[model samples]
Target chain A: MATAVAKKKKVRINGCVAAAQAAKYADVDVITAYPIRPYTATMMALAQMVANGELDAEYIVADSEHSQLSIAHGASSSGARVFTGSSGVGVQFAYELYSPISGTRMPVQMMIADRTLDPPGDFGSEHTDALSARDMGWLMGWSCDAQEAFDNHLLGFRIGEDRRVLLPQMVCQDGFFVSHITTDVELPDTGQVQEFLPPYTHPYPLDPRRPVSHGPQIMPEQGPPLQLERARAMEGAVPVIEQAHDEFARIFGRRYDPWLEEFMTDGADVVFFVQGAHAVTARYAIRHMRERGAKVGLVRLKTIRPYPTDRVKDALSKFKVVGVIETNLGLGSVSSGGVLYAEACAALYESPTRPLVVSFMAGMGGEAIVLKEFYWMTNKMLDAQKRGAIEKRTHWVGFEE
Target chain B: MPAIEIQRQMLPMFPSPNQGARFYNPELPETEPFVPGHRTCAGCGPSIQYRMTSKASGDNTILVGPTGCMYVANSSYLCTPYNVPWAHTQIGSSGSFTAGVAAAYEAMIRKGKWKGAFPNIICEAGDGSASDIGLASISGALYRNHDCLIICYDNEQYANTGIQASSRTPYGGMTTFSPPGPTIPEAKKLFPKDLARMMAAGHPHCYVATASVGYPIDLMNKVRKGLNHKGASYLMVYTPCQKGFVYETPRSIDLGRLVVECGLYPIWEWNPEKREFDYSFRPQNMRPVSEYLKLQGRFGHLHAEHIATLQKFANEQWRMMKVELPAALIRAADAKNLVDMASAEAAAAIAETV
Candidate 1:
């Protein structure tokens, strides 16, 4: 068994190029783009792909993010594999179209290279852009590196376009950390991608041969059923995502946990709960802590949309203390910290032996949680466990006293 | 990979079943894409325009409704009047969504994914959506030259939200937001944006035209013609609103004609090929602006001077259309020949009695 990069021809590329390469392999029919850092780099690679005759597709430089998403939704509705992306507030700019794209069951794939929101403009990773639209019925997840980013793009298309789970997907990566930084990515052969992802054929498309009305204004009574259907699609995507990963592994030779990736959690008492690219750094920190016999592990959340709630609860229940990482802003939210802390708290609340859950506002505004900070956070968790009562609900990392 | 050859032909335009000189109602498709049974007001001008536009497009069409009267009124309670594939988009998404649909079909057909002649992608945006919020988006679509028809159904006001004045609301037009008060007698101070012409000037490649429900044949023909054009096409159809315009429901079509005839609404097309204005379109007879305004209760508060101002505005429209102004129309523009509406005077007189 070869590593994913070793099995195929690996190329040193940034996250943006990896996304474009995946779109090329997927044979995306339409690529709508609105330039915003660092997602703009993905569009640049795609523009070159179209220009070089590498991909026979429509590359539309959209007027705005709202237009970009609308274009994606419309393209998907017309039964075409559409790819589009945005970053930071640009994602929020197109927020209005998110629900309609999914509600109509258009499996449009968006590459969100995370960036901080406005006022003090910063081109850095923050999950708030994609996380805010989590409940919009899109199969959402984050990639830890360029290789996983490429792999996730392919897998996202396969799972989203599945007949049982017709939904849009958000394939996210950290802005400068993942998008701009170059890494080794194994570009799969076109034949393998073809086998994994079938040509998308929506049940009800805008076709003259078969006329069907989609996204019609429904009755208030009908709202529940339509919502339930969307919920079912999100819920239904769990097995489909698992199947996509299994099939993806068989074809591309990269096996990944579809929900949570537990790193050295065996007989561990405390675990760090995180998502996106930070997990890569978290893995190194966990290994160092394990070497020191600190009994600390890492739990990387993969699919955040369908949430894998039961899986999360089961996995976190094994640990004595769970330190949730807050990378995105959620003002006035439960836990009054990042958005993920609330989700983690709720998932762990139903546990019989609830872990001492604490939120650490780390890696926000694109600052990486360094090795020393991880150790400091682990000590805080250890103190909470030793005292048998949590010191505080949340820690602002460097800011907190 | 082999290239697929899709048959590209215009849907043969047939003459009106009642082929009378006037009211020559073209034989509309029996398969109503915008069907009855939905809650559009009786004699809804925009609704009529919708039915006509969809009919012209036939079954092989995708209607994109922006947030406006058409979206709220037609597709209420999950019951869409659209039998053909339709989707509602944000008000400002009118052009972008339609562009997407058009772009999708282009890529799909070219890539040999979806086989068939390209579906007629159409956007039925309200005046507010088109003139204000969605202007830039529609401009973008037209500039990109997406093969779609974006019809800005101009009812002048935001009819769905209880008649607020939109950018398309004409000078002296009264609405809930533009009521005549002490400070401002001319309810809506600004002139209506020449949206269709702006579209034509900005995106010259697109086929742009102005039509009204007043001329059913012309409106349907323009719809078909716009759809026929390979590139983007914009048609701003003058849809009279009974609720917003404070006009009699039965006179919806009548107002349509009156508006055009009085030169308030000019009927013309922009020939993208020739890069010229097609001023060949003409109403039957030029009428006085007073005659057009008198039918609507919204204009009941207008004084003689306001009516004269409207006549001046109408004169400018006629001049823009290159139509010779009739002596009577010129005379009406003078304040000497005008008087305040009797209703306005009656209301003014009843102040103390009340």
Candidate 2:
């Protein structure tokens, strides 16, 4: 076993390269792409890999994101392990396909380097692009850095293609933060990935011999049942996610909590709740605050849907206050803020010692929440604890007096 | 060759029902590829085409439906009518999606991932989806020469959206968006775009043809011929919409025959191997234009002069197909022979109570 494991090579690469490497390592049969912001580099790298004969794949340069997803769906339906990606409005342009792809159970994997949607066409990182597709029955979450992005891409395939959970995945990372930022992403050898993720074999594909209908028109009565099936698949994915992460850790020697990532919250008084790359920054801020005698920590949500509700309740129940750092927009939402605030507060509502949760609209519109903003948010949480209630429903971190 | 010899030699003598009232549904396979019990309206002409198309492809087939009534109305709430592996593609991605499916199958069969005879990959696009939004993608797929069959189920207008005018809608057709008012007597002034002919002319190498629901056997044979072709093939079929045409639901198949019989819809194929047009299809009877028009509400507002103009247009279409016009059709094209609906005193006297 030791010798077998030792035969697998590991090399350090950047996130975009790591994603392309993972796709190559998985021996993807088809790769569809359309150029957009941070995600374009991944396709560009894969295109070169195909040209160099490193990967034997059908590399299709699609006309648009809509075409990209459609091609991916078509290829995957024909029993090819397909890969594609997009960023920002590119994701939205293919919105008509998300439910159809998932409903057909194609198990197509889409890597999204999150970019803010335009009114302003800013090519900066924001969760809104991917977050907007949260309820589309896709297995979606964000990766903090390059290594995690690579592992998540591999794991996404396993979880998505699993017969019990035949759904597409939006394996995402923040634009420029993890998408462009270089990191030491340890690339797993082909043998390791083969052991970690078996080749995709859809039970009912578009095969001539064993034919089956996909994404067929359903009657009204049938709609609820299929939706229930999708819901059950999502709920059923919780155990599969944990099992996948456990298996991934066993194979690659990298451990991660599949749902909630807790940091220094054993005896902390206040915890900053967040997701994505901002969690790494918040970790540094929390450590600095700990040394300065502040009992503030962080709880980073790794998976947004099939949201780790119980884990979140247990992790933050000891804290007196929980501040959700929303890095995306929710223009006319209940909090007059972001969507995570509603989810975080809703999850905590069932807790025994439901902490006084406050939504801090920071890191929004692709503006990274800095250490100073973290400290400021913690002070607000501390004041809420002193006052025994949230001062307001939302707080604009840097803009407010 | 003489006209008599040409007609006698070229036309196949399939026995027509003696009563001229009997409808003959071709003997189809027992296989239910596209089954019944979907949300398509009571008598969907396109659904009829779909059933025929799928039946022709047999069991080893993959169907692609672009965003259209067939995808929406047929697949609503997830209760599928298809017994085979059917996929819904984007309206514009019909050709491209079908291309990918074909490519995947080609690679799979070669690589031994899928072990079987190659499945027939077919795309069914509505006229609105085909002639408009999806035209370029369809052209691209044909240009790429993917092994697939694309059928544009042309129902003249966009029927699923409640009868909006598509590029294939006929001249003076009264759709909701193209309603006739006092100022604009003819609702839609322009004639329908010659889509099938354009496709044939554009992609000469492809097996391009025109079929209608009026001729089910001919349509099915064309479908088989397209699929049997090694590379890409395109077929544009005239499928009448009862709601859109404002005609009786039972007359759906009748209208298909009437359009062709009146020389309004030409049925021909572009033989890619020979680089020639095969005008081998001939309707059972040659009817006057008024016999086809008086049945639909869209043409009800036509004046005598307008009807004569349509008759002239039909004669020209017959001339294009090299079909010699009978003397009656030539005389009908004259405006003096046409009768106004409001001034038909002889017809009114026949219906008088006295």
Candidate 3:
């Protein structure tokens, strides 16, 4: 079979540009932007795309993040595909819109280039920003690289806009590691994107032709059913997400495990559970450790929100030891560490064969989890496995011996 | 990749009530975008303004109700009064959400997706939203020139939250947050913001006007004119609250008229085309501030000096509009020439009893 290299157009670009390209290919009708850190690059790319006649969309530079999300919500409610993005505290600034956009069932897609929350104003990667809104009824996930970020944007729109799951999505990536770092992403043809993602259409939009009232005040008794319906839609999205990914793989020729991505886990006793861009470095560290006859592997989580509870339990049950790498801050959370540890432990607690799970607080304040830190985290997990019991629930990486 | 002939709806302007020798009620659009059977208080001023604005916009419209009296009272318990396509937005998202709807329609029509005339996009924002929290959002929408209308129903204070002082609350207005005290007899010390003029000055390209629910035909015509405008338009309406103002329920329309006649709430249009103020729209007759203030109990706490200050403020507003103040109105600005409200004695007796 001929490789057909001539047909495939590959471009070296950052995650921000990849997201903009995905939006352009998706042919979004409206884009609302408010500049913050690394996420601002995506808006800049989108602005240029609109300026150069490359995309026919209404690009509004909003006054603030709150307005940006509101504009996206309004456009989505009016039956237009909306694309918007923010970072760090900017994501928190628009926190008010998260619940309403989802509860109203507007499939507004927001690209998040994750940055650490402020105090010192660090522009590095941290999952806390997007993770903080985990309970807001949004379909959330993290992409490891520019290519995955591009793929996730298109996939996010398709899944979120699905009739069964008319909810907003947070397509997130690490701030500098993926958002600023350049990588070769194979851009798909317009025809492929068209076949993969249908034009966004809400069941009932704010159209005079139809004349439907949305978000009306309801009686106290009506509140439960509405919330239950939203819950049903969220829980019902699992099947839709799988179907979309299957179609995406068939049309785009690139497959991704919709829930979790397992790498070199064969015959390994200890594994690192990670998310986002840090998985790229974790893979390298695991490969190097495998050469030294160290039985360490990587199990990277792709989706966090309609959290794959069954999948997480099944995957971790196979290993004797699991080291949860949390790149977020949950100050008073369980394990006295990040929130991911609690999710991992809770997911595994129901499993018959529970792995001795330990939380590692690495990548705090947007600092990268270097290969050395990964090795250190692995040693702690190995020690726990060797003793047949864990010393502590969490260990602060790069802080402890 | 083709030429799309976009069609837009142009609502017919209602005739002025004061057009000729006799005042006549102009025939209105039959479509009741804001219907009955809601929780708005009896003779609610904001509700009247909402009814008038939505009636003017007709059925081919989308209303963005921010967190305010219109959204809370009108859409209580999963029931809504809006017969047109309406969506409730955040208090601060008034303009941005409206802009989004406008942008969506523009793109949808241009892309040949929606097959109809462009619908009227209107945002019914409370004074709290227009003057404070949502001010920047409204300004952004106007500056971006989105084809929409943002109407700030100024009921003086935050009437929805049981009467708190907003930036648009009058100087002598007494609210829950600005109660009359030993040190602060005037209650609210600050003057009301010139919201409509601010909209006009900030976004000079937008159609900015001040209307009162008192003049139904004029208010309706202004709504039509705003929809007819190519881009963003702002209308700050004088909507008196029965609960907050402590006025009689049936006197809502009367208070609206009296406020304008007293020269406190100026009625004018900022014409973008000529880049000048259109002061042609005038109240029927001039009245002293006491006549307007005495109708509402919110101003019952005002002393003679406070009344004088308010009158002076109104005089300055009249001067700003280049209107000549009558000699009697000028004399009323002095504290010596005025007396306290008749209820002031009763209020003092009650305070002494407490």
lDDT of 3 at A27: 88
Off by over 4 Å in 1: A1-8, B11-20, B24-31, B342-354
lDDT of 1 by residue, B152-210 (tens): 99999888888889999988888878877667766688888988889999988889999
| Quality class of the docking in candidate 2, CAPRI style | acceptable
| Comparison by TM-score, 1 against 2, better one | 1
Error of model 1, residue A240, in angstroms: 1.3
**By TM-score, how accurate is candidate 2?**
0.86
Tens-place lDDT per residue, model 2, A171-214, is 99998878888877676666888898987898887776666667
Residue A156 of candidate 2: its Cα lDDT?
Answer: 95
Q: What DockQ does each candidate score versus the true complex, computed on alpha carbons?
A: 0.53, 0.29, 0.60
TM-score of chain A of each: 0.97, 0.96, 0.98
Pairwise DockQ winner, candidates 1 and 3: 3
Q: Against the hidden true structure, what lDDT does model 1 obtain?
A: 0.85
Candidate 3 lDDT, B274-317, residue by residue in tens:
88889887787999899999887788778899999999999998
**lDDT per residue as tens, model 2, B40-62:** 87668899899988887887788
Model 3 alpha-carbon drift over 4 Å, by segment? A1-7, B17-26, B342-345, B348-354
Which candidate gets the maximum TM-score versus the true structure? 3
Clashes of 3: 5
List, residue by residue over A106-163, the lDDT tens digit for candidate 3.
9999999999898646998888999999999999999999999999999999999999
